[model samples]
Target chain A: MPVYNARIIVTLRSSILDPEGTAIEHALHELTYTSCTNVRVGKYITMNVEAESEENAREILDQACRKLLANQVMEDYSYTLEETEREPA
Target chain B: MPVYNARIIVTLRSSILDPEGTAIEHALHELTYTSCTNVRVGKYITMNVEAESEENAREILDQACRKLLANQVMEDYSYTLEETEREPA
Candidate 1:
């Protein structure tokens, strides 16, 4: 079976308040990184999957993101998938 | 002044055990997404910055990541920076 590497980025919806982001932005200002603004914090997920084809891998990853990796109501998720050779055992 | 958009990705060092990742992986298996493996979870941060030049923006973003956005002991961070035109009032 071919292996696929998928990187998923899940970000808070703009309308949602991101307290983590706000605190980080405040810390940045305290550190004198005053230029930083509009900071939003989210999740980054990387997964390796075994599948028959690239399309199959994408479908699996999409489902994973939609079901468990991200909360669809408050966050939006996007992903990139690439095929890789299986490592020699 | 030019605005720059920076995306920062922070992930746990492979040596570190990611409990969140493990939990998500278990959830995936329970959901019957059996092909998924080696799931790692991290932080995704997007920031808008005001800088005179791209180099300045990159410097500021790097400082933000190293000092405030990521804990250097157990996590590793990387970022991408792009210059964008200022939004009109």
Candidate 2:
């Protein structure tokens, strides 16, 4: 089976409040980078998926995102896939 | 000031133990996604930066990443910038 490196970016819906991002904004302001604003934070995940084909790899990745990596009700996720020769750590 | 949207991804160094990732791996395994492995989790952040020029926007973003967005000793971060019409919330 071929191995695929899946990089997923999970972001909260714009309507949701991102307190951590707001906190980071204040921290940046305190650090004198007041020009930085509207700071929203989310999740970036990378995983290795072993599958029989590229299409199979994508299927597994999508399922993983929906089942565990993201909360579909309040968050959305996007991913990029690449072929890799690595396995799970 | 021109506003730029900065999207960043922060990931722990490979040498660092990502307990969160490990936990997710177990969850995936439980869900019968045994093919997915080496699951590493990270952060995705998006912010607006007001600067005088593209160069200035990049500079502020770099500073934010170094000082607040990522832990230099344990994590690494990278970003992409795009001009936007949004402001702080």
Candidate 3:
């Protein structure tokens, strides 16, 4: 089976509070960066899936996102897929 | 302060076990996708940071990643910085 790499981005909706992000923003000011402003936080994921075609890859990816990769309630996710020349780690 | 959007990706090193990824991979085969193979999971975070320049943004982002975005023991992180024409949410 061919291997495909998927990069998934998950982020909290704009309305939610990000305590960590806020703290980091404050830390920047302490670091002497007065220009620093609002900061929001999120996550980045990379995964490899086996599939014969892009459509198949998409199908597999959708399953992965729905079942495990994303939490649909507070965070929203989007993914990009690419074929890999080397085998997945 | 100018607003910039930073996309952060944090993943466990290749040697670590990912239970959620494994479960999702298994579910793919259950969904009739036998071709699916190794799947790794990680987080994709999108954040808005206020900074005057890419260099300044990077300085702030490094602090953010070290302080909050990533767990140093198990995860490694990388980020991309981009300017947003619209105000951050």
**Top candidate (DockQ):** 1
DockQ of each: 0.93, 0.86, 0.44
Question: For candidate 3, lDDT tens digit of each residue in A8-49?
Answer: 777787788888778766775676655556666676666676
Measured against the true structure, the TM-scores of the candidates, in listed sequence, are: 0.96, 0.92, 0.71
lDDT of 2 by residue, B1-63 (tens): 779888998999999999999999999999999998989999999988888998999888888
In candidate 2, the residue pairs with backbone N, CA or C atoms under 3 Å apart (3 or more residues apart, or in different chains) clash, namely none
Winner of 2 and 3 under TM-score: 2
Model with the higher lDDT, candidate 1 or 3: 1
lDDT of 2 by residue, A1-89 (tens): 78888899999999999999999889899999988888898999998888999999888888888988889999999999999875457
Which pairs in model 1 have colliding backbones?
Answer: none
Instruction: List candidate 2 stretches off by more than 4 Å.
Output: A86-89, B85-89
CA lDDT, every model vs. true structure: 0.91, 0.89, 0.74
What range of 10 consecutive residues in model 3 chain B has the weakest lDDT sum? Answer: B31-40
Give the Cα RMSD of candidate 2.
2.6
What TM-score number comes out for model 1?
A: 0.96
lDDT of 1 by residue, A1-89 (tens): 98999999999999999999999899899998889999999999998999999999988888888888778999899999888889886
Q: Judged by DockQ relative to the true structure, which candidate is superior, 2 or 3?
A: 2
